[model samples]
Target: MSYVKDSDGRWHTIFDQTKGSSCGPTCMRMVVKMMQNRDLGEEQARQLVERKNGVAVLSTLTSENGGVGQMGSHNWGNHGHHASGGGGVGVGAEPLAAALKGTGIKDAHVPQIYARQALLKTSLKNPGIAAVGWGGQWNGKRAQGAHWIVVAGQLSNGNILVFDPIYGIGEIDLSPAIPKYRPANHEATLYNKNVVLTAK
Candidate 1:
């Protein structure tokens, strides 16, 4: 699914990467849309980030029981077969921030927001799009690995307005979203740092 229509009948872009690993770029594209109101497709965002950041952002990443990394080409129990779970692959905070800056977004910064209070405070302070790293479960199913999404803003009740590449626009509570955060990993942490692009 490449898009989902919101209640207002506006079509929001959902970067479906079932065939490839490009969540980082997809989230960046969503940020561009939320911040600058410009639409950049998945491929375009991938190319732009890699080109601008001068680094390769695509790779086969795997996760097992909330763990992320390359552990051979095989899963734990089945050491003879290929890895059958987790497919999140994308850029880290530094590269993502660099890519945004390369696109002329001056307000991009990666902040360490590990708690809901921090996230709320940061979201309130910065009034633009945020590329948030999401893990844990979605739709009653645990995610294979880490994923990236766009945080448009915080609602009055303190829920975040999220624009997921796979789930589209919705609101999620900060409770479940925060604990799954593996702050030790750069790609899985919230915000990857903060990116609040000013209006153009």
Candidate 2:
């Protein structure tokens, strides 16, 4: 069965929380819940994303940004619990790092590509949550584009458990192999990943 922090935790989903773009923030919400049992509301999560270097507003829009490329992350450092401004402009490493800096996990490491898979696996295997960047769905394939999601844990079967905000697949099996993006298939897959945040 798919797992989520709790029924209340699901409310942190992007659609439930932001009228704008927020895959990255929504994923962070899951990270906060996985790392800590806190049920960060969408409003609170959104506020954390907008903190510091977050792109509170985007100049352009993309499908991944949910047509609202004008907002930020959610969850940790969410003492403010602010709501998203409402646009789908997704964030990159810089914004994510900035958001981390504002919280107790300021030193969060975003690994370089060469070591990404290993670090992600190690963190999840160590029973830690990993906030990851990917393509939209990540259905055991390579990433075709950019999106954000959470790596909740590793299943006993050795498959990766992915928490896709849009698909809402709880702990779905993601093979160890990294799938590449195929224009024809459009299979949402994982590409690069990192231990977005963790316990100090």
Candidate 3:
């Protein structure tokens, strides 16, 4: 994905790649950078990054369930394949919330809270939080590595400074709806062609 500034002075990220291997780290780094600028302590910022990554959480979830799937299930449903897990919708939120519950920031409810906020058209007057999704194709078919992104920030101009795990830090307008699913490898190209966000 490449970050570009449009003529309207808004920064947009284009996902030109077929997979999101680099996307997660890019997004995480962007959020870290943003947090650093916000005066969050180094330990706190590192913890936030760890929660955003969700590797440990995913591992714990998998270990508890003897692997996460029903019978004959190749794909791990919403949790996604273990190798490509942690990038699914809302994956980052629960962990982050758990991490920052006692803190006074009140920003722990990032993933789910932001998702519902966007869906409900609520004002993000407090610390901004966002969730990301992979809405496009992967390898010319559906289910070709679909994923989600989580971003958080106060709104500046008409756009929100975002930390999209599927893309990266940038500004996205408030009119778009978050995607419900991400395509797996070999099934992404035709996964969500021409799908429009009618709400939120």
Candidate 4:
């Protein structure tokens, strides 16, 4: 499978990855969609990642046992969310990579990308897709933590293109996405760290 674009050269429709805090899963969904050139809708994408990552069973059973909004004494609950409460918990690299491995997608690599240079060299250069972790200010505004977005491509002028599940499709105009983010293993506060999902 290869990345496909519309007649106008834009990526396909953007889909939300989760009803709750499932940024990793959502970004994985974005990677899958772009790599396979398919529009796997939001609900299905959310379910697939959860199913593969073992969150589905836990969420489903919890929902069944406690009607979705039932948050227990231990503060654990179902991913089948409601406006009230009781929603999903997010996963990190291990589970995200495991899910990708289970799919057996050729040329797919779920590796921890620690440096921004490497991310640009590998991911954006190929006009490829990457599930990137970024934080701090984005588009000159404050952003959230442990979040994920799919990098679609980059331009010669240093405009990094992406498809965000929450913010929709846009550009990551910032090189490294965060200049101050010192490269680290698990840090998501800066764009320096990412559990990148890359495919040809």
Strongest candidate by TM-score: 1
Backbone clashes under 3 angstroms, per model = 5, 20, 24, 0
lDDT of candidate 4 vs native? Answer: 0.45
Model 3 / residue 107 / CA error / Å = 3.5
Error of 1 at 60 (Å): 11
- Candidate 3 CA-lDDT value: 0.34
On lDDT, the stronger of 2 and 3 is 2
RMSD of each: 8.1, 8.6, 9.8, 8.4
Model 4: residue 56 alpha-carbon error in angstroms: 11
After the best TM-score superposition of candidate 1, give how far the Cα of residue 134 lies from its true spot, in angstroms: 7.6
Ranking by TM-score: 1, 4, 2, 3
For candidate 4, the 10 contiguous residues with the lowest summed lDDT are 68-77
Q: Per-residue lDDT tens digits of candidate 2, residues 1-200?
A: 13444222332322232433456667666655554556666665566666643344432222332322223332222211111222223445445555555544555555655323533443342222233323433344333234455554444645445555555544433443553322223443443443454433
Query: Candidate 2: how many backbone clashes?
Result: 20
TM-score of each: 0.59, 0.56, 0.40, 0.57
Candidate 3 lDDT over residue span 55-123, tens digit each = 433422121222222432212233442234333322333444444333333443433233434423322
Ranking by lDDT: 1, 4, 2, 3
Off by over 4 Å in 4: 1-11, 55-89, 121-144, 176-193
Q: What are the per-residue Cα lDDT tens digits for candidate 4 across 1-200?
A: 13335333654556665455554556666666555665555555555555555523332213222322223111222332222232223444445555555554445554456545534654432333333333344445443333455665454556656555555655554554453222222223333434354543
Question: Which residues of candidate 2, in runs, are more than 4 Å off?
Answer: 1-17, 54-89, 114-119, 122-145, 170-177, 180-186, 193-200
Clashes of 3: 24
Shift of residue 19 alpha carbon in model 2, Å: 3.3
